[model samples]
Target: MTGHVRPYRSYVYAYPHKTAYRPLPEPGPALRDLWRDERKDALSLYLHIPFCEVRCGFCNLFTRIGAPDELTGRYLDALDRQATAVRDALGDTAPVRFANAAFGGGTPTFLEAAELERLCDIAEKRMGADLRAIPLSVEASPATATADRLAVLAERGTTRLSLGVQSFVDEEARAAVRPQRRADVDAALARIRDARIPVLNIDLIYGIDGQTPASWRTSLDAALAWQPEELYLYPLYVRPLTGLARRTAVTDRDWDEQRLSLYRQGRDHLLAHGYEQVSMRMFRRPGAPAQGPDDHACQTDGMIGLGCGARSYTSTLHYSFDYAVDMGHIRAIIDAYTGTEDFTRAVHGRYVDGDEARRRHLLQSLLQARGMPLADYRDRFGAEPYDDFPAELAAFAARGWLDDDAPDGLLRLSPEGLAHSDALGPELFSAEVRAAMAAYAVK
Candidate 1:
């Protein structure tokens, strides 16, 4: 409506993309000092595993292709050291609490069963985050979702297991540069069900070359055959430095139109099948086993992240080790992370001022299908969204994207607005953040 009509610009799962972060001055704020005044009653803990069996074409996540046995060992050791440092920073007097935990990465299941056990120990024993008592979620790949690795996760009380099966069609998978067979994916899904994780989330992609509406329905029906508790429909974006970026040249109009069509088709198909939309990308069965509090939010809550790829969020700051997507740079960052000893202070991060925090809160809350409660925003910032974003809301209204029929005090997006979430998300980005992201040279 405001110019760019393409639905997908960026997937803003987190506010302020990591690229916006810069080097902190020597010896940045101590973790304890950073958390001193922040709320800790309900925090999120995340551990990142930067190893994957193979690099997919459409992937730009912070991970490497493989980790030798020794590399995995050292990586865990470094994780252990980081856990100790982080726990020390949290201090024992007040009893820090974790509401949920997740093991994510290139593929968390890449670790052996024993190593997985150790990873859990590092979280529970060292950091005092009880995986068994909390909702633990882990990501796996078709090749890495072995019985042994899955057993470790289930035994440690993983509430959800998200399998990255981008497509059920083998050729489509290959076209996406993710070489895999449909049979293997089916086998992996079977194993996940066998593990009996409370919630199973299968991720699929649309907009791949040659993916038709029929083929899209085929994949969706296949996923439904398993009665997956959750499914994420991601539009394939050939991010810079990714495998697909090298071989693919997409015209924005045609590609965007194709993606939008597939998205609507997929959305309608799922809705007809009784799955409720959670977001443009997420859909879930009505009674899926709940993973966490319905109110769990990342915008205001604090998070503790371990590993080079993970970013820890405090109320005022988000920090992590340097980020990279290039294989060479990724390997170098991982090596530095593995060899590090004293992981005491934040070295790289950005300070979140009042305006940035407000923007983050709005973007995060508004992106959900549930919309955002004006009361919540007003209570937090003492200002309404309309007061802060009149022009933006007016533009969305002009395009009929902002939902006017939402109940009083609730701000929501119309169906088309949800479709353009990717575009709208970046539209809210502060000029400073956009500038920073634009200036960041991908290493």
Candidate 2:
């Protein structure tokens, strides 16, 4: 509705580069040393619920369809064990005041009410912190949301709930295999509103197979009708192993033009409805109450991810377990808390050459629609961005990708740069940085 729709070829053959990511052995004293040196307090926790009642066509997240209820209960027990292990590892070094806690997965609401409460209790007891004060967010599918279920979540300190409403059109919804009906989404929103939860974020997707500009606009209009506190717009990404990727007819979709149009239209509609653009994909209404950070906290402030398929980060190392729900990875991570292992080696073993500190700072700044502060960089790394990335900045400025007149100590993206940000971002990095990132593929 607001931006141009340009037809471009979808890179069907584009393949992610292979990386040397190997699962680390169980935690030992070496891992413990890494945690102590980081001195992390005010942590964020992500609980991965890997069970879903139904699987969406486009999803590649670590989840299984039609998981038995008994299996869900077993996973909850494992989660409790993992949480305790993580808490013992931190041991009095930094008072663990949680900044944020999120329940993400196949569908957090899919868990039985008692199971959800037990998981929260385990996290609170093991972490030995006031969990109620921290912002607890969860992702829920509309079909799984009931008035009683939402009430349970709100009463248990869930301040925010993100509803996955990919599209409002029945045909498009069916094509994407989203489980809930449009009416179900409305009922879920009404229930959440009745509970008086402060923030509700609706997740909308564009550029899916069979999606059109008109259909996208319709979805936006329907979402606006609900007046959610925040809206997240994402282009559908085709993962190689997913059901959507296996659909041969997907090759005919106009993914490029559809994405551009969705972005433009969604932004315009949200702005008209009094939502301010907080980041590239997020929009919030003006004068909204202060809330916790988005998804980048783990990347910014070093977080200890304590479940299967979760990734952990420290100042120097970044490690992730394989996708399987293996208890061995959890035990290994616990072991690392006691001994002295080369954390840098542990992180690099997964994706070598990742400078967690630098990457964290840079990514945080980027997420804020700003650039890294020169002063902060100097204080932390004893080097200036210009000094470290002189050639890259110069080249970026020459191409009008960066503003030469930006504040002396700030590295902010220009309006033009923001408009075409995806293309412009890589220009800020040196060839070596790009190569390193390509080689790593942390996502």
Candidate 3:
């Protein structure tokens, strides 16, 4: 435990923070120019809902605990406005086609059944995205994943429903400050199964204070009972501004070793249960219904995001409304988002240069279990990944993390490397991006 290495840095999910984004001085025209020559064959649509029933202790996402009365309605109205503005900006030149759609955030299902219907309508009617033609995914929480709400989502062509169930043991959940009963979780699973959605993804967390290997196994078994289409095992990080941050420090190496061991245990358990390891944290049941559109992927395609916390991406810029973790800041951003009339230009984002784009391609590919196809990298960037990222690739190989000699010219992670994905992802961040992210004010 004393010498164990853990992932202590930032979670490198998306590149850059809203802090890196500056106001577009020209607004509408600037956005039009940015999207002028961008590829529009396969674009992803993301709609964010920033409200939650309760903020989990280990959570540090851009979402508020609860919305005041009428806030949800107003938020939808604002989303409609933004969608209209964005569509008009794309105009006739950008023949954008929706390849996939997802509703994410604190919890999209937190809205009432009727509101959820309206949410879908905005994406379909206002944004011109055919939700029924493409794969649609939505996130849900046990307390908010009501039957009526699930029905609304299912009716709107939701192919996959992901539910977050951190732990099956009530004590472990309480230790994580999640505050859920096993019975409620079980009931939620039952309801999700009854929803008859094409796919179900169950999310679990490891490394909670009181969670042991045995308890982790118990939760895994409980989740497996439903035979979910996908399972995402997340390692809990107590980040600043989160409820658990005040109670725990991020510099605990002993906890790192505990998490490493638990991760291995859980990974092995899921593998033995006939689940295929998709990455360090994701497992898919073979033959499960597909989750997203096959044509579009985050690695190359553009995305249009609506709602306060949602981040949209073009080839050059990734933009979003102001990002914040503290409740006060989140509420302020949401309020401002709901009040804004102009949505043509980016408000906050970091620019992606050629180098940054290369790095993004590598990070998006290398961190997965399927690994990066060397041929594909060369084809996209016109340069070999090893040549561009020589030092990083060599260091990873020396650390026994990457296998450079895989067949078909593929670069993939070893089993040990997969376990250290959290560390590897942050290590790939460029110095400039790292500095920008580090300088961001969490609140």
Highest lDDT model number: 1
Candidate 3, which ten residues in sequence have the lowest lDDT sum?
292-301
Q: For candidate 3, lDDT tens digit of each residue in 1-443?
A: 12344554455566554555555454433567667788877888899999999999999888888888799999999999998988887778657788888999989998999999999999999888998889999999999988999989988899999999999999989988888899999888888889899899999999898787888999999999999999998888888889999888655778878888888999999999899988777899999987663211444547888888887788888877677788888888889988898887776777788898888888778877888888888999999988998988777787778765677689999888888887877777889987877677668
Q: Write the per-residue lDDT of candidate 1 for residues 35-108, one digit (tens) a residue.
A: 88877878899999999999999999999998865899999999999999998988766768999999999899
Candidate number with greatest TM-score: 1
lDDT string, candidate 2, 1-443, tens digits: 12342222221110111133354565423555656766557677777776678778887666666444376666666667667666766667566567778888778888877877877787778766455787888889887777777877888788888888888887888888665678777888788788777788898988776787788888998988878888887767666456676673544335555576677877777888889877566788676555777534545445666555456665555665444222233334323432322222233224324343454465456545555577887888787767766775675566555656778888876644444454444444434545654565333
Model 1 RMSD vs true structure? 1.4
Cα TM-score per model: 0.98, 0.82, 0.96
Off by over 4 Å in 2: 1-20, 25-30, 248-254, 324-356, 398-400, 403-406, 419-443
Instruction: Name model 3 segments beyond 4 Å from true.
Output: 1-5, 17-29, 293-300
**Native-vs-model 2 lDDT?**
0.64
